[model samples]
Target: MGEFLMDKVDLDDVLDKFGVFDRYHAVSGIFLVLGMAWNAMWYFNFIFVTEKVEYRCADHLLPNNTSANASTTLWCANPAVCSEWVYDNPDSFVAEFQLACQEWKRTLIGGVQSFGLMLGSFIIGALSDRFGRKTLIVITGVTGAALGLAKSFSTSYWLYFALEFLEAGFGDVTSPLFTLAVEMVATKSRVTYATICNVGFSGGLLVVLIAWLVPYWRHFQRVLYAPGLLFIVYIHVIDESPRWLLSQGKKEEAVHIIRKAANQNKLNIEENLIDMISCEKDEGLSFFTVLGNTLKSKSLLKRFIVCSVCLIACTFASHGLIINSVSLSGNKYTNFALSFGLKLPSSILSGYIIAKFNRRSPLILFFMACAALCIGQPFIPKSKYLLWLLILTYMAGKLTASMCLNTALIYTFELFPTKTRSSMHALCLAISKIGSITATQTPLMMAYWSGLPTAMFGGVALVAGLATLLVPDTGNKNLPNTVCEAEALEYSDRIKK
Candidate 1:
């Protein structure tokens, strides 16, 4: 009787009967998927506004003997000092602040936003796991939207930077929303669900369109962030995750959601069986205790460490490639768009490969392919004929790296258990911040050697890929809800409590 209390016993068992893709799931999914896309853009929207733009000293004299002011259309990158500057994109943060010589400050913009994301995920994600994903999602969602919208009106760069930090640290919903999105679907569709959430012309690609449609930074931000204001209404619309309810020992709430879902799906659930659900909340285990258990297990701990290495490498490669894409010989806007825009296809292919094949093999192959292309990029001769080759090779690197990054994300989701899944995912993301921060300085690395950043991306990716063999494969496995279940992931390591 204790073991058969509906979801408390086995959520998948109940979810199987309730119907994973019924009307209830479909309605809830639309809101959650959109939520995922919205959350994706806010983190990197700074990329478009702070992108490197054409600028030259504003105090200089033009060839016609006319003094250059902010309105001067002519530009030159002379190696001379000046008090003022002219930027091609007057609305860009780079242009508005005259960061022509103070390039480090411009780079700091990305660093600050990445830091906010890292800190927010580590701190707020834990809070969500403890309280509830739904509550935290609404609070963070509203707060994030407000801060981001306020940033559009800021005149001072420092004020803008502060707003960026505040918005990201308080508003990051990826971790919570990610778990929620995946949990709403069944295990068989988890990969497909993850793929669609990102590949559906999500944040990176959308920003390109938004930036093109409204080239000015302030106005663009207003247009981009205003829709996020609707997140406040999610409190009434989005349902609390059923798995989270069961984990917290809220049997009644879980039953309620299940019953509602069943009725919506036109399925019949035995009310008497639901009434028989009598059990404690997994003995009221604290999050730390369960997490500690995973760390204690030799199998789980080994996997965690290896997964961290892979994630760090993935972020480094992904960020470095996209940030450096604009410098390639082509239209800057087109290059930037292709850098992320092409992920739509690569994501679909990666999802299929990882699903049809095993997770480990495709990861190894993708990372190796990306590493080879990136490492070879600098060797391409600088010439009109080979410029196409250079861009093609670079874009290829971006494509494979994107695929590898996606694989790393889904792989991490499978390796951990539900007891501390979000917490663990947040930790991995937080740990990977080192790569993101380092990636910001890639543009600066070109001074020492044009190929230094590219080579660096390849080297790290190479090592991470080779190391993937050390971690166990989790293809076509059920989502584990306990440390014991996670330890039993591989048959050889399975232990009976």
Candidate 2:
């Protein structure tokens, strides 16, 4: 009787009975999304830290006049070599360190920070898959924040930058939390869970922008880094993912966690049914096996490349549109907040649309619509003549791009099997960072052509939309536990010769 019951029970079937958003998941998700809101501050902190500082030459770069001061000296047609600079904002790092002529140093700090974040994604994602999600989340989340707070005391530029690198390379809690969120819910409810977490991400960005009112960098750092420590409490509150536990062949432990959820949801699950549950094991902890399977499978490899291209476009456009959104003539802080406001709303709408229809069509539509909006940007005349029109058009692009990114993440997450899902998603994120890095330098393209940045964004988005057609739609599929199961994710569209 036990053997018969064990053979008949499936994990998803048991979980679906708990209902997608049960009280257990609700309690777990509260901690996870709050962690997201806290993590978002550090992730986008560079936008505040590297803000442009107003400066002027102290000496020879200006015309020789005894009356010349900081403001009057700025009119110099050519900003030649300068031994020193005067600044308006004394608390700014640029002013504090006297980084008058070395603009690249300022920019390099941002680049180094990004590079560290990229590396963190790879290391933490791999570790989470092997070590367990709750452990890494507590360790990395607190450690990263502590390192970031430590940077507040650095007296030298290089020392401050070193802390920046270390803090970022320490990894984030949100990645593993996101992995846990989808796995905790039913297939039909995955989008709902993912978007709610994403809203928390945007919420963090909004929270950090308020730091513009903090007055001092150290004070903001303290405020930003302090909340992250609260995540350490997750160790006691949250347990390991039952799906991951089952994959690792820890059936008794997985069943214990399931029982907790059943009790919280008040579901009268059968004791015999629970007793007969079995765990599913996949290819070992080796990430190589996952990659090897992809390399060998023709359809998966094709789908892999297609998802990569879409991710590239999503990351690139999302970053580029953010910079453009703030470049409009207005209060940079207000503009930044309003620009990203659509992020939260669009994610909710996109999740509904994807859950209702299918993944491929909405993704294709969002990407294509973003392409159209961005492509027409240069022809829209100057902000002075039609300010609302300019903001309206580009903000629409930002909205669509935000939708594209959220959907792309869910699509990629659904594409791979559960065992390697976090790492595979991380790899895609790491690859997509190339586009992110490139987008940062895109303003340089304007030296060659005034409209080049907008043009490039449109081009990549168009390519991503077109490339998406080659891949299968994952809307109708369940989370695949094995590579073979994932191969049929084309909504049962089997490979044909």
Candidate 3:
């Protein structure tokens, strides 16, 4: 009888493992597709759509003309140029365009809004932890898709501004989604799965490049909506995290989901495998209680602090570069396109480097090194070869950004307990948003005071370099599975027991 029971236990464990793997594969696949579709804007045309159209108009209108008749005359000369002229001077165009792309001092406001999204995601995170991951994923996905689609039709700047905020807020449901993916997957497979999913954000760059080849912003707007629409189809294939279900006291539901996962992975289960006893916490838990417990934990706190600052530094530097590129750099479109294209190689290289080195070390060294290069940028000779050199330096800054984003995501997930994962991740995002807010002005102010973009990038680089050194490493380990595990920890503590 004992031997027979042991055999059943082994079979159950095998089935359970297979189920987790199946779920990871499916969800990762779906998110990869969505990421490829959506994130390209950062690299592709998101930043330049306004600039491209505006420049086209500027080139045609001969600058400094104010009459509607004059604009109309120009428009008649070339219909495409005419359309660009109208968009160029709309009362709200400058503010709406800057805010939309998060450029200049407006980037500060935009960054704050990003924090607001984190706050929104925080609420979403709690509700997800309480209700079910499936519902929030579906709801947020729909909200984001609707907002993105509606944005294309917006007439006035305010209307577009409102939709832009909604689009940013709703699109970020992915923060919690990342936590959910990490929690639902087996301990060993997480890094690989998360990294692969993250590659989707890079894949988005490829799509954006295609959009850049097009001449019109309206068409680009149409292309931007495609990813959000594609995500709607995922509602059928994905479900709530079983870990969340267990935490919410839905043992039977968790079992059903797990069983389904096994079936999806094509694993065979013995009838007696279902008899194995599992630890399932079905008791309703308080959000305050969970939050307090998570914050007070030492190990989790260390991980959180390091992750937060690194993220902030990275965002400030990389996002600042992206936001200020068109205005600061000499050849706006070409520089922007080259910078965007570099993200692919940066992301690919970051993945490999993180897999090979200490996370914190790379972050610290790169920021400091990049800062020196940036400060010296203004001194570069204004020749073709010199311009290429400046571009290379700019690419270095972008590469650091990619490294920071990747490390923060992987490291934070690994450091926090499964129960508080969403909160921790949200907190990191919130801080990064703050960094972005500060960065919005870094270049503009530097230029105004010093009349040099290179000098500005260098100073920002110094700050980022210092911030990167302050954190510890949390890579290549199991995540904390519970709040208790996160709290009773040290620098080297693993979130998972």
Candidate 4:
């Protein structure tokens, strides 16, 4: 009986018996993806709303009698030509605020958002682990929606900037939502759910592309807010993660949810099946305890360092390439759309690669591919054909970076135990946000030399790719539910070696 109990006493077996990808799983997965799509709208909305449209100095600044040609010549002569501005698009923040020559301020808008994301990752990460995943989702979701609406009505750049920061803090819900999604599903289905969430995120980019038809930034911003309303419905339909429930000693609630899931899939679970629902009785394990344990474990610490480095490199290269692509010799809308569209296929491919191969190879391969492209981008000669070539190369680099990002999402989710999953996920994202903050400065780096930022992106990615070898591959393995289980897996591997 002890042997039989041991054979059937894991989360994976329980999930298998419960119907891993059943009707309930399908419904929950759909809602999770939609939630992800809503988060993505605000995350990428800045790209569209703050887009640099064509502008020139206001006519009054040119001179009273200035001909169009003389006005143009005089405008070129004035260093402070942005005293007043006429923009091709009357609604963009850049045009309204006369930010033509003040490119750094424009960059700040995105930079501040990234900063908020960084802050949110740490704050909300801890809060989610403490309060529960669903609670934080509702809190952050409502707050993010409110701020996004308020930001649309800002009367000044500073007001908009302040709101952007707050909205980002509230709006960066993807990491926690990701943790929730992974925990809700079966172990074998984690990658599929994560990739589906990514697909929804890419769908948010598509929503932005479609919203571009609205023709005014404020109107576009308002449209972005419309999706957040769906969160209200989410409050009614979504279930809290049962794994998280079990971990918190809410066994009754966990069993109820699992039975409901089984019923939704048309399976009648045995009444005594709850007896097999085994988990470590970690009633008071807090984030600090996990951190203390992690700090003491050489393997855990090494895994943290390697994973963090990989995340930083991927974030820097990906965001820098996408943000800098606006300066390339193509229509900004087309470039942005194409760049964002590439994520769809890359996300699908990432799911397949993770399912079929070890996690380390894909990260190493994609990061190195991106590095090669970034390093080669600056060497291409300036010509009409070559310009397109460079753009395609850059797009390929972005695609590879997307794959790295998708892999990292699953890799990190699987790397840690359930007790510390949310916090560790948040920490990884916070590190990536720092990399994003750095990527925001790519424009500043470009001023010194256009190739400099790409070179930096390449160098970091190369180091990250090589460093990936140090982290263990977690493909096709049961996820750890406690720190001891996580460490045991690592130690057992070492013992075999």
Candidate 5:
């Protein structure tokens, strides 16, 4: 009888013993998708900057009213007038541009605001682990939407900057969505489902494409307003993650949330099922202790450096193409369309292909392609056809790097312990922003010196290629659950061989 029972208990049987019932609640899934979609608006910030800055600066190059025919002359207004005067007086234009740049440097360094968002993610993730996922989701959604709306209407630069920080801080509600969704679902389906955010992120690029087609800043603002407001309404219907509650030893609340989910799916959960179970204990350390632990973790430190290097490289390459979409000299719309167009299919293919192949292979190949593009870009002369070809190459490189970004996130999250995972991930995000800030400023400065953008993008691609070698392959193996476990893998045959 004992032998027969041992044969009957396979891994599948074990999982089924602990699996969730009524897994397909329509309301819960919809709310999750909507909330994630709302969080995707940050990707659209590139589009916002492109349109707003372009609209403000386009007439800066135009001839003044005094120089043109009276009938043809149109008196400039607001930003348009300030641009005209600056353009007409060549000597003073640089000073004015410098002043404007100084005044709004923080806005340009928008990636710096990512630090605050990381703080919020750390705080909210702990709160979710302690309190409830559903509560934080609703609170974060409403708060983020309110802040986003306030940012849209802020009257002063400092006020607007403050609100932007608030928006970043609260909008991180989606950061925990991965952990939450994976925990709530059955283990078998969790891998594929949690990764749906990759496709959603690509879909967000399409959103930016459509949003960019809006000619002015105000019209674009009006369009984004709806998504922000809608998110708050949808948060009410989502259920909390039962896995989180169970981990925190809140068995009753876990069972309550699970039963509610089951009820919504028209199934019944056993009342005493949760009471019959036991789970491993979690220390639930404070944020500072987590940070200290992460700093002391040699393997985590190595992985963090790898991620940071790749992030800086990827940001430099991707934004080299993204930042130029609003400039006066190039075909802005065509450039944006081509870059964003490549990203959608590229991102989807990456997720699918990476699942089947060794992770390092794709990254290495993409970075090499980027390197080749950089070496060849300088030779291509400035013409519409050549420009389009360059744009296409740039898009291809960005698509590949974007895939690396997705893979890095998955890799980093798995490489750390649960206690310090959020903080470590947040630090990596902040580091990645430093890369983006450099990318934002580098091309404009390069263009000022050389009067060529092709060279700038090419140089960026080269740097990104060098960074690829620093990233470790994180595929086909189980991630270590503790610092000690992770340290053992460092000298494993995979690396030694």
Candidate 6:
């Protein structure tokens, strides 16, 4: 009987027994979406609060403005040596910190947050795999929210900068939460869950637009952190991933959770089904062991490298377009909102495409489209109509890049095994942050030549898109349970081709 059960039981089989979109999953999905949205708010909040609004040298710096032309002279004066800046919004971060002259420092504020995200991905991700997904989510979510709230009360620019770093380090909760969310659902529903998470993220981006209504940046910052309070409720309602539990040799606990899930779904799961579930070994592998094992396998190593490149390219292209889009000649608020809004449909389309087709082709096509648009954006003449066309094309590119990013995200999740999923996801995200860091420099590149930054983004994405073709596809495939299983899938895929 034991041999029969062991031979038959797998995660998918269990998921099939319990309803896939049942009550337990619905509840868990709601919390995960909210958590993911909150994470997105923190990650992208810098874009709004630190925006570069129009400014001019202080009144005192200019000669007595007895003549109307003095106003014009003040605007035309060398902005670098301004003693004090008069901004369109006196309450914005640019005005409060007088950061107009220190444009590079302004850019660093965003870059530093990405640095924090990179660190959090590696450190917190490893901890999630070692401890438990729910534990780290609660810990990071609360701490990150507190730090974000503290940032609203910042007394100095340096203090705010420090808080940004800490907030990002603790607030990078999306990856683990996403992993848990995916693990909770059946294999066929993974794309749906991923797309839902992306939609949540897009919702968060739209939420940031509310900053336009607030009178001050600090007030806006406070609003952004308010959602973090949901983590308290999440701690009570969210369950630990049963897969993670099984991997740790906690079969009884895993069974208990599975039964609870089954009960929640109003399905009658057999006692024998729970008994059948078991782990091969529970030696408690560390993050380095997983990393070492992945690197040792040539097949996984190749896949890892390829996925990393895709991640970087997607990060760079998506964020580069978003940040640079603000500089376009139009209402900054509208453009920003429209750029983010494009994600809603893009995500839906991405989910459908990946479900119907394979991962590699759609990803490659999205990247290529983004590259084409970015490469073509600069060539349009600078008339008002032409500039709007340029903005349209750029936004289109953003949409394509966003699709690639969402697709790459699910693809990366499918590429790794259950044991190392969180850790490997974190590594990919950490490497992607390097692309984000590079993206923050787009403004600097624009100062040299407006087209140079977009061209660079296009060129990088082109290379990454071509490289994606080299990786194996996991469409309609079962999630692997171990490193060896993932390697076997790759080997089998190669043989079939």
User: Which pairs clash (backbone N, Cα, C closer than 3 Å) in model 1?
Assistant: 58-85
Please give, for residues 191-213, the per-residue lDDT of candidate 1 as tens digits. 87777765643555777788889
> Can you write out model 4's per-residue Cα lDDT over 397-448, one digit (the tens) per residue?
8898888888987887788888888888888788788788888878788768
Question: What's the TM for model 1?
Answer: 0.89
Q: Using TM-score, give the best candidate's number.
A: 6
Badly placed stretches (over 4 Å) of model 6 are 1-8, 59-84
For residue 245, model 4's alpha carbon misses the true position, in angstroms, by 0.5
Location of the lowest summed lDDT over 10 successive residues in candidate 1? 70-79
Which regions in candidate 4 have their CA more than 4 angstroms from the true location? Answer: 2-8, 18-21, 59-83, 281-286, 495-497
Task: Please identify which of the two predictions, 1 or 3, would achieve the higher TM-score against the true structure.
Answer: 1
> How does each model score on lDDT?
0.79, 0.78, 0.58, 0.79, 0.55, 0.82
| lDDT per residue as tens, model 2, 1-497 | 86654665667777778665678888887888788877877876766776667776666445554444544435444556556667768788778876765666766666677677677878878777887778888888889878988988889899998898888778567678888888877777788889888888777665545577785777777877877777778888988888888888888888999999888888889887776666776556666666676778887788778888888899788877775555667987777787777788888999999999879899999999999998987678775879788778878888998999999999988988888888888777767776777776665566587667877888899999999989888885779987888887764855532
The Cα error of candidate 2 at residue 365, in Å, is 0.6
For each candidate, what TM-score against the reference?
0.89, 0.92, 0.76, 0.92, 0.75, 0.93
Residues 1-497 of candidate 3 have per-residue lDDT tens digits of 88655642322243335532365466546664464446445223335443422322444544355554445444545565433333453433343453322234333335434554656655676666666666766666666667767766777655665766666666555665666666666555555556656666665555445555654555566666656655565567776666666556565776687677667666666545544524456345556666676667665566667677766766666666766666645776665555555555665666566667746666566667667666666566757767777667767766666666666667666666666666667767766666666665555475365335445555655675576554445555445556655544443433332
- State the displacement of the C-alpha of residue 422, model 1, in Å, after optimal TM-score superposition: 0.8
Tens digits of per-residue lDDT, candidate 6, 150-170, equal 999998999999999988887
List the candidate 2 regions with Cα displacement exceeding 4 Å: 1-6, 60-81, 446-450, 494-497
Cα lDDT of model 5 by residue, 416-456, tens digit: 65445545665666566655666555544653644355455
Candidate 1: C-alpha lDDT: 0.79
As a TM-score, model 3 comes out at: 0.76
